[model samples]
Target: MKLVDVGGRTMAYHRAGAGPALVFLHGGWSDGRAWGPQLAGLSDGFDVIAWDAPGCGGSDDPPREMTMADYADAVAALVAELGVEAAHLCGISWGGGLALAVWQHHPELVRSLILVGAYAGWKGSLPPEEVEARVRRLLAEAERPPAEWMDAYLPTFFAGAPPAGSLELVRSMMLDSRPGGLVPMLTAFADADLNAVLPTIAVPTLLLWGEHDDRSPVGTVAQALRSAIPAAELVVLPGVGHEVNLEAPEAFTTEVRRFLQAAGATLIRVSRATCALCGQQAASEDVPLTWMTSVEDGRKRLYCDRCARENVRSIEGKLDPVYW
Candidate 1:
């Protein structure tokens, strides 16, 4: 366990594993501890870090007012404090939104991103009233029997079938959640809009969705995000739901491992194309053109202050010495 003081609040985080850094962000109605299965499964091959959001588990609440960016900043601070220049990020449900927010604000710090049952905005095709009603009902009956809620709520998150023991574990995590944390988090969810920021994320992203996710359905939202982000890959789990990570840990972990491995390898290749001025790689189609521009010659023109002062460097000059 470690503590990171960000925004005047002490955030609690648990760390495990011994390889490449990987951070897991839990969804609403759950704390970092909810990732027990994943932490155990992946710890052998990766450095796993999971933290409790403000007002959840061992973390202190944020000041009276807080925004999604605040949460994203907190994560950035934690990543920096850990001395990690970049890491593979995974977020579930509400945490998925936070992960996207983090990537939007600090793409350079993320090696790869995974979003499970996440949304870009709150204003989807579902009517506001219907959305509110479902949320209200879930919150209202959260304290009741585990089996009952599982029977009712589990379907909305998974696909054609639920995994064994998933219902019980999810029920326990929900019941243990802090209402104080859940309420504010839910309020934030109601107002979240990553549509504008989505295009800005340059890191490789894997968008995972359960075929039957009612809260944030897969088809339209997932398709729209895939279209919006140039480097995003979408995967639909056949018999899963909103809590696909929890329901099918093996499948989810496998997909995440594959994506991270590929992203890491690509990062190695791009590192050799470092810009003379900023010491960062030349922007490629796989990466966003944050400080560069695409010219009419079907090539990415370098726009680094140092490189630009000397005139935009041609790709032909840089291509001779391929890094990979």
Candidate 2:
């Protein structure tokens, strides 16, 4: 586990294994830990990184009225901070929507997209009344006290009884979230409609959903996404609900691995970089973050994003070497 500061707020993430990075974005009310199963299951073949989105887990609370672009940029920064050039993006529910936003803003950084029980955005995918109703529901949910919120919200996540401790794990994560986060985070999609952006996505996309998903029913949402996104494929997991990854992790991993494999993506070592100042070494992709450059004579130098920031003033005055 590691933490990075994005836009002044901190985000906690878990990274494992090596290869093409597969970034997992968890859904609303949940944190990166929601992908625990996938992180462990997929780490062997890919560089899996799951982050605690703002307002959940150990991450900082959300700023007032965060928007889709805000969420997307934060994710982009998180990915850039990791030093990966491009990655296969996977998101669940709201995370799926955020992933779409990332695609719209940072297409160059995404190699492919794996969206599970996703949406274009409530405002974009659902009728006006439905969107309002959903927003109201989330707002009401945010009003509940921690214990009551846990008890009331936990059951709806799964179609059937969850294994022992599973419910507790989810409950704790949801309840741990800052109450003020729900309204803005949930309502961000209220005015967004990503329908037009679907056809423009040039990367490979896999839309996986739970057959029994009442939260974002597959027949309606999945079909709509499939029809809109060019050549996008959909897979429905029978008996699974909104928490498809948590409910059928093994199956989810199998499906995603197959999708990514077919798309010819796997974690591979990136070019390496050596800091000119401290002589520290890291993958070139991880540079700018963990290491930085300096030119003592006439050679190019590399430095860390952090250390570079500290010397931003001096770096700004450079004659030719510029800060990125």
Candidate 3:
């Protein structure tokens, strides 16, 4: 365990390995230890750092009024204190939102981003009311036989059959978590909205989603993210849940390793015609250009034809015939 003074708070973190820094941010109802499986495997290849967020595990409790931006700032401060110029950032669930916030506000410090079961906001698609209801139910059931109760809630987080011991692990973590810490974290999550900042993230991004994640459903949130962020890759894992890293460590590590390796490469081949406007390779001619945007001065600033036409129509009071 290591402690760093971040904004007057004693933040607790654990580090291993010796190469490029890789920071792991755990989701709600979980602490940094949730990333144990991933750290165990990835630490050997990279410098893996996992920390307990404010009020969780070994960290000091932050005020209940703390916002997502505050959490992101804390992470940025930690990176600076460690003298790491850049690092790979990975987060799950609520932590995923924090990771996105960090990337949005501190792109220069991020080498790449990996988000699992993340959401843009609670407004669109998954309404706050629905998420609140589900979270309430799960929290209420925490005192009961966690394994059995969690089995019912598991479907929302995962896709196919739950992996052996998956429920048990979740149950243990839930039981061990500090309920006092969870309250404000959940409140901060309810207030998060990363949509406005998504496009500002310039680092390579990989979104890992469970095929049947109810908390942050795959189709709407994942698709929206893929469309919003340029050069972002979405990987939907079959038969997995909200905790893909725990449910399928092998699969999760494989995808992460591949993305990191690709990110480190110097020469990337992108189509001239397609890459001219959007810096990504066009997989097929039929690929939709709605989300494809142009990068300007190292920052992706190009808007798709649809967005351009919409802007013109909004201002000119008429649709452009050429765009149509």
What lDDT would each prediction earn against the true structure?
0.70, 0.76, 0.71
lDDT of each residue in 58-172, candidate 3, tens digit only: 7888886877787887888888888786799999988888888787666556777898888764543367777688568646754565445544655565565556776666667
Clashes by residue pair, model 1: 157-241, 157-242, 158-240, 158-241, 159-240
| Tens digit per residue, CA lDDT, model 2, 274-316 | 3335545554342332222233433223455555565422333
lDDT, candidate 2, equals 0.76
Q: Where in model 3 is the C-alpha error above 4 Å? A: 132-155, 159-166, 266-324
- The stretch of ten residues in a row with the least summed lDDT in candidate 3 is 315-324
Candidate 1 ranges with C-alpha deviation above 4 Å = 1-8, 124-152, 160-165, 267-324
Of 1 and 2, which scores higher on lDDT?
Answer: 2
Q: Each prediction's TM-score against the native?
A: 0.76, 0.79, 0.75
After TM-score superposition, the amount by which residue 320's alpha carbon in candidate 2 deviates from its true location, in angstroms, is: 33
Q: Is candidate 2 or candidate 3 better by lDDT?
A: 2
